[model samples]
Target: MFEYQLGIDFAKTLDKNDPLALYRNQFHIPKDDTGNDLIYLCGNSLGLQPKTTKQYVNQELEDWATLGVEGHTEARHPWLPYHEFLTESMAKVVGAKPIEVVVMNTLTANLHFMMVSFYQPTPQRYKILIEADAFPSDKYAVESQLRHHGYDDKEAVILWKARKGEELLRYEDLEQILENHGHEIALIMIGGVNYYTGQYFNLKQITNLGHKYGCKVGFDCAHGAGNVALNLHDSGADFAVWCTYKYLNSGPGSLAGAFVHERHAHSKTLNRFTGWWSHNKQTRFKMRDAFDQLPGAEGWQLSNPPILSMAAIRASLDMFNQVGIEKLIEKSKMLTGYFEFLINALKNEHIKIITPKNQEERGCQLSIQVKTADRSLHEKLTNAGIICDWREPDVIRCAPAPLYNTYQDVYNMVEKLKNILNE
Candidate 1:
């Protein structure tokens, strides 16, 4: 824990000494109508655009304009192997081997694709277990998967609910669920970080626990990748998926990344939906060859990727490769700790933070639960030129992304909130 002090000067001093402060200039922070930079703290939802993203996307456009169909093989990055360029850097971000990572379809799509292979449910072990308050998309995906396999969705889906009056989930409760119903549970798919409370679950602990119960474990890391050192390979998870737009600073709705454990990389019996791209790269263009599946995560691909989206992803991954997740996380803890300090300093009775106090148990995001306050509090903050997100019910999720957020931004945001509350 850091001994944080009060006031603007303390924040200024922290920003002045920050080694990563200069990196904020690389992003285009949104502005108010007066043209001043807004305190953008919504990286958990949509990251601010990297200034280099335009240049990266433009390169692909130029290649298409000049070379037409030859762009697939002759472009600067070469469209045929375009997704390959992202593998190493993306793997580093998520802590996996290049062979275990692939940048492909959207987040939910990748989750379904991974489920197709990993979520094989038998009559005896056909139920799915998930966090009770999982992101809606994940809950829907699992429910649909349950229904698809001829099980009653409501009956087959098990919820790992927080104890009454609790906002965060306890591992002991999850262990209890496994103890009671582990035999019936076919898969344990959870969000690496609870999207609402911002509590980061221990991937290795969960994986080991599920495996002990003979359940395949996977994570939807949409809120974890680029925000934490997931160490997916070492976690021993069966699979994981995440989007590039948030924290990675890629453009909105850009490509997502997927991971398959190295143990399953060469398995020929894994049931997956594949296309020409998943065939042996050597014979992929033969046009008459059979579908000889490629090994590792690439074997899950169903089509050629969109070059423009991959280009934007490359632009962000290049930045991540330079800064490294370790240094970024180092700054992230300090920055978010300072945000927590300032918010707590307000001593406001109307609001309290729901995110974990332990830095190791969370990322940059802090979810503030406002007592009896509605969306109007969020609208007030927005009108004051501070941009964060409002989750349903009563939580304001503000993520001080270390790469582009500074101590000064945190200081200014809290000061504005204090004023708004006082008014």
Candidate 2:
């Protein structure tokens, strides 16, 4: 257990000794009117921009101006194959193979695309499963897919819910659901990390259970991509999708990523939406040739991507490549553990942390469940210049991202929260 202490000096000491502390300077932390850096504990919503993002994006802009259409094949980072440049780094972030990973459409779009191939339903097996409180977009995408497949969304969607009066989901309940209804379930689509409660599910275990029941499995790793060691390949999931804008330090609404396990890399028989980019690159320019599909996840690309957004992703990923996900995860555990300690020390009756107590079950985010069920607490936090987010109804989510957040940041945030609560 981490022996966390309650003091500004202790927090400073931890920061001084931290190996990843230097990485904080690489990001652009927002400041208040008084010019002090705000305690920006909201990487879960959107990561802070990297210091190099402007330089990376400007290079593409300059190339586009100078070379026009020639930028596609002759720019410093050729636009035609630009997404390929991100494949290796992105694959490493998610523990996927290069062939299994592709940077592509936004999160929900890729989820729908993956479902096109993976969520094949039959007369007997037409149900799709997801978390009860899944992010609204995932729920919408899956419900639409069920309707598109000619099934009643209400009847065909099975939700793995948390037990009554409890905040976290149980694996045993999931096992029972599959035991009783897995035969009818066509696909198991879950969030690799629960967005609201900050629970990181065991992907490998979920995949194993789903496959044992003859169901294909997939995950929306939007919250897990750069924050955890997803190991999507080893998890044996049929597919996964994640956005680059959160915990990735990519710009707002940046392109997302898709992962198709190596097992399906060459599965040409899989039905999918495709375009010119999906055709074999060597023969891509030969426009009238037969459609020879690219061998792997690259086959899912629908169009050539926006280079500026990708440039931001490339800039951020280069930092990830330097620090390595392992070190990030290691620091994440300790930093969040320290935050947990401080929150618990408050002994404030109005507050309760709904996220899991187990370190391995969550990322840096802590879902602070306000007993009052009002936005006042979140407003107070914002007024205090702490940039966390408030989920509807009752929760205030604070994510002390290890990449840029420091021990002192955590300490000050908690101290400020204590002051707010005492008032």
Candidate 3:
């Protein structure tokens, strides 16, 4: 466990000793009107751009301008198999095999596509299970799927909710829900990391329980991808999906990733929505050839991906490859632990941390529930040049990203919070 200390000097000392400290310079930190750096603690929402992202994107633009249609096969990186460049690195980030991982459609789109194959509902087992506070897009997609299948959304959606007075979800509660209604559930879809509370659920445990009940299980890993070691393959999940714009540091609305367990990689019989890109590459160019599905996760592709957005993803993944997820997570635990310690030091009655205190149970995000606090407080923080995420009602989510955020940044942010609370 990390032993954290108070005072600005301690924060600076930690930053000096941090092996990943130099990485902060690799990102383009946001600046104020006077050009001073803002204390950015919003990686859970959107990660900052890497300095090299521009160069990476420009290369694609240059190739497109020069090669025209020939860029598909003859450009520097070769656009025809562009997504292949990201497979190995992305697989490493999400802890899956190359055959099991693919970078493709947006987060919700991929979720729907995976559902096409995995959420095969029967009259006897037609329910879909998800956390009560699953991300809105996931909830919407699943609800739409149920409606399309002729099931009432309200009747078919099962919520695994937190207790009346508690904020964090318990595994026992999930077990109880499954015990009673597992037979009726055709699919158990959950967030690998709860977006609101930063709770990192045990994916393997959830998958095991769902499979035991004869249900297909998958995860929406939007908040967990680069922030945690997901190990999607080892979890034995049927599938998983995540966006690149968040912790992955890709540009806004960038392409997303999907994972299918290798066991299902070659299942040509699995029902799915396919297009020309999903066909065998060799026969894909043969316009008159019959549809021969490409094996593995690549079979999910609908159309050729945008190479510029992919360039941004490549820039971020290259950094992840150099640093390694293990090292980043090690620093994450320490940085987040230190942030927690400093916040608790305030000893204020109104402030309570809703996110789990256990390093193993949560990521870098700490959801601070300030009693009676309102949007005015959020406005104050913004005016003070602190960029944090303000969820509706009363939560301030701050994530000190391990790649670029420093210990001093955490200290400064807490100091600003303390001053605001004092007022």
Candidate 2: tens digits of C-alpha lDDT, residues 143-208: 999999889999999999999999899999999999999999999999999999999999999999
Better of 1 and 2 by lDDT: 1
TM-scores for all candidates: the values are 0.99, 0.99, 0.99
Residue 254's lDDT in candidate 3: 94
Model 3 — which ten-residue stretch has the worst lDDT?
1-10
lDDT of 3 at 140: 98
Q: Candidate 2 has what TM-score?
A: 0.99
Error of 1 at 66 (Å): 0.5
**Candidate 1 wrongly placed segments (more than 4 Å):** none
Ranking of predictions according to lDDT: 3, 1, 2
Count of backbone clashes for each model? Answer: 0, 0, 0
